[model samples]
Target: MPEKIIVAGVPVDTRHFIGGRRVASPDTFDDVSPIDGQVLGPIARGGPAEAEAAIAAAREAFPAWAATPRAERARILHAVADGVEKRIEELSAVETHDNGALLRSHRRGVMPRVAHNFRFFADWLLTLGHDDFETRGHTNHVSWDPAGPCVLITPWNAPLMLATWKVAPALAAGNTVVLKPAEWSPLTASLLADIATEAGLPAGVLNVVQGYGAEIGDALTSHPDVRRISFTGSVPTATRIAASAAANLTPLSLELGGKSPLLVFADADLDLAVDLAVEQYDNAGQVCLAATRILVEESVAEEFTRRFEEKASALVQGDPREEATDLGPTIHTRQLEKIDGFVQRALAAGARAVIGGHRRDGQYYAPTLLTDVAQDSEIVQEEVFGPVLTLQTFADEEEAVRLANDTRFGLAATLATGDRERADRVTARLIAGTVWVNCFFVRDLQAPFGGSRLSGVGREGGTWSFDFYCDLKNTVTAPNGWNNHG
Candidate 1:
């Protein structure tokens, strides 16, 4: 039996799920909780051999799974969603313990979204439409065929939610998957495997391997059998994976890093702008789509900065389990150090720290705000991926658009303006995958999601997801009279 530990009163198993069974590795690594730096348990350490085994299982299972009826696949995926809903409380606690996100956010928002991901994709698959046309007495039809074994490498920052964002769609399209959860938070993925099994998903249909990216990521990505690769993480890592996948000419869908901007116009509602600014601190500022760079209209820059600084400083930072705590600790000491380093360097370079600029306690960095930084500075151009925000002022719409599109990363951006025409005109000019006006992070599962330029390649969500996970083949019938004459 695999080793089990109790977290938030729920027992969590820390082992790899491959071939529909819990497989133990020769060596194991400790899974320390970021909440208090306590060792949650020892997780199986998988290497190339384990990666090969998991891939083999997925390859063996792909044909039958692909041949399964679309209705049947949809039913199984719905069951998976149902299973997730039944254990929402347990999953929420485990994820909070594993990743140091606020318990309330996970319970109220993230976990529920995870279930919705499965349910939404399942229903969408059944009602999916295809293209068919008739011309010159011949008919042409387009059909989506499932690709073979797919490898999914997910990031630690929104562990299970992000994982299912890809998994649900891949499985719903009849592709088998080998998911590799980030090493820092592998507990919930283990639980997810068990949930899928209970929901009637066949063995080898969904296998998970837990370990560092260096250990098994290459083995899975470079495998000859892997037909599709979908990854969500850093740009450098994605670059390496792209290089490896190039060997086989394997198709890839990458959702990479971002230093997204949020523009606040002078005519915008001050209260709503302030609320949206503070929200960048959500998930400890580890969000890819977060508006970390704030460009305020010159007339309202001072008022907006003061309000943002005051509200950010007052955020309740404490144990994630506490309901009143608005902020949780960073994922670990190293991540905390990295976040602090970004702030310290900006200060040394003549920028002003208007509010927070230091670590408060164990793994808890203060919510930070900076101003008077040059537009071209490293702190403004690069992605900090922490609870840090930088303030800048712009003169007009053209300047706002310029500053927003100045960075190499273009995952997402937001605009806070009361002018409807301005919203339409400016959003059209912004270089982002998703643009929001008077709102932030409001996502519909049916809409397209992903980034552009250095942010990412290809889109996912709705039919865009099926486009990446399946192969579109067209069939044409012979003209009726010509066939008879021949």
Candidate 2:
């Protein structure tokens, strides 16, 4: 039996973080751990009132934070990064315990990336400047100004990292923010609020409201004081947010769902292709950018499927606290059933499973790979968001592109090929926001990140993120003796 490890010493209060203090709500809900379906603790369940409070706090803080010198903001962001780094281990543990994510993944991958997000945006803030143009008769200046009070809603898949993805850039661009984390994964986010306060972030600069989206999502999106909203979640929810934002005519950015593709060409490195297929099983396929559709050339399809099956089956799905576990349980029972249903439907449609076609335990679904699935089948077309990969073979590059681009989502895609020219050509034709030629999940913090089509609207990361959190302000100065009719 594996030794059970429980996270201790961290405050388990799941209250809202407003104005640098923890505030409790009249009502609350239990946070159940997916690991064994036990109640971890009760979390303050917030509603419109909580949302209003957070937005008001941010509204009050916007002017001072926006007016602070760029260098000063950069310094404070670095301190926030430092605080996260110092408490990295505990923070990762809290995330693992709350989200049922693998311990190693949070400790090494997500936590460090969260810290990097802060530092990257802090460095980018230093390079921000006003553009000046002196023409024959007049001078013009263009500058970036904070978007005032903003609402940042992040998903639960990688809570801290995704939160930082939105928060760091918004703050770096001088916007005071109200963050609404997914209720399923709120522990790390609540902790991050305390960490940021300790790092010298002023009161009301950053507030976290923890509750269900149905309760407070509209409140945040439709509030008149909110200048912008950045969201990452499902398409249906995004549509609702869009509608709410429209009521106030507020600016918005959304990174929504994806049913991404991973194409393997006949001329590609076979070993590398197999490796990449197995890698998509990471985070138990809960990632938005995960390659759920595997499109392989007919010639190498058999070999690739064999190797990929071996690797996928070998992945350990055990206790998240266990060091050797490669994958953890799904975020909740509903997710586990959803993935299981997809595999069952595919099987019913005559698809063959090479391995793993059943759920193991509480919130634990086996790493599944389906072959011979029809191109238009529900499993192949929709986002499974689980540890399931469906394979389909194509005869040529054109067919492969056709099969890959069939989905409404164009968030991310990956292709494996040794030829640089082919790689470049195929990637250009691929309808994805981000395409990887020979790699998987190799990200640069400075690159613009988001999807096209239904995947997302607008972008984040690098200067793109800064621009989203701010509005461009332009000024014109006329010459001393200028006339309107001149």
Candidate 3:
């Protein structure tokens, strides 16, 4: 039986909310489950007008929200955590239907993290500060303040959690938001806005506008009123948003896709390494920092490949709502083709598919694992953003390092080893913004998270994210240097 879900206390329809009002537009799009082509709902398309309304609403609410003390902001955020808990099961079900994120993962991984994001930022908000210094000769201090109302665009992958990473901190820092969710999964974002409202957040403080990025996103980015734009999406789209925002001088932060590599040495714990690599490529490998490229030592290459292929094959592939399902489908029809193209390119470039490498319909790309993948292949160089895991063997420490850094992306990487020395050495050589030793995807909202190189600019989570969302308003202690009042 298909599970029915609701958003914002209202059932799904082609109609979408524009500025907290139920508005119907002739433009409508289907919300299909990636697991299959099941239509959960047909969502309405929002255009520039809706985007402008959302911006206006956020702008109207910005002053008071920004003026509110950190504690008050924290209070609201805390309430959001509480509110989300109430609907956790419903949210999980919707996630399975909308984006095809595994329900069990939603229960275990996504929801708790989403809740923690608010609570984490809430804690940070309660103790906001900037680094300062006092010397014998003079005093120097640096601080930050909210940038203003912002435009945040999040991807379909990890929608609620990643969106919270942007929205939680932005809201906690006193900046209002005009959030444009991915077309594939706007329901959750709508629910978040409703949850905030239910939590007593002032109207327009955290506005959600549902629409196509072409219409809504462009308007929000190009709007004169929007002060900052924080986005998590494709490199192409992010570049466009960055360029458009540059026209108005609105500061921006981004977290783009990744072809993150996992380096496993012969000296590494085989069990742990295999597990970490699998974990990195989990979520049907639909993660930004997923270990799409696996680099292992030539010594353990044969054995590791055997073990990994067996383990990777064991991953359950079926309906996301089922507890037994380990992997779900990609976001929608578009990505199915995109991921398929990448797979064909990899095969054409001489990489061998050691395990699963196919798609069912246009949604569920099989949990794939490719081996003997050349470093120069697209699978190694670009972000596949699917359940595909491509493996390449490395000769030694130098070769391992070389293979890991070969990609254009520098989002994150996982290094597995029992040897602390090797771990330290690899950690130094790894090019990513975040390095995980013996683990994968261990994220804490209190810490800075982002990427280097083409992966992205600036950071998210921790105070580092707020730094981008704000500017330092210096309050120099202007000392009277003798006889000002002559």
Best by the lDDT measure: 1
List residue ranges in candidate 1 displaced over 4 A.
481-486
TM-score of each: 0.98, 0.96, 0.93
Instruction: Please provide, for model 3 over 151-208, each residue's C-alpha lDDT reduced to its tens digit, 9 standing for 90 to 100.
Output: 8999998889888989998888889888878888877887787788789888888877
Residue 258 deviation, candidate 3, in Å? 0.8
Deviation from native of the Cα of residue 127 in model 2, angstroms:
0.6
Better of 1 and 2 by lDDT: 1
Tens digits of per-residue lDDT, candidate 2, 1-486, equal 111123446665577889888788888877777788887777888899999999999999999999999999999999999999999889988888888888888888889988999999999999876668888868898788998998999998999999999999899999999999998888888878888898899999999998889898888999999999999999999999999999789988999999999999999999999999999988888999999899999999999988887777778888998999988999988888888888998899899889898999678888888888877789988888999998999999899999999988999999998889988888989998899988999999878889999898998878788778889887888778645655
Give candidate 2 regions above 4 Å deviation. 1-7, 479-486
Q: Which residue pairs in candidate 3 have backbone atoms (N, alpha carbon, C) closer than 3 angstroms, thus clashing?
A: 284-387
Writing each residue's lDDT as its tens digit, candidate 1 over 166-241 gives 9999999999999999999998898999999999999999999998888899999999999999999999999999
**Separate clash counts for every candidate:** 0, 0, 1
Clash pairs for candidate 1? none
Q: Rate the local accuracy (lDDT) of all candidates.
A: 0.92, 0.88, 0.81
Model 3 spans > 4 angstroms off: 1-20, 131-142, 480-486
Least well predicted 10-residue stretch by lDDT in candidate 1: 477-486
In model 1, what lDDT does residue 382 have? 90
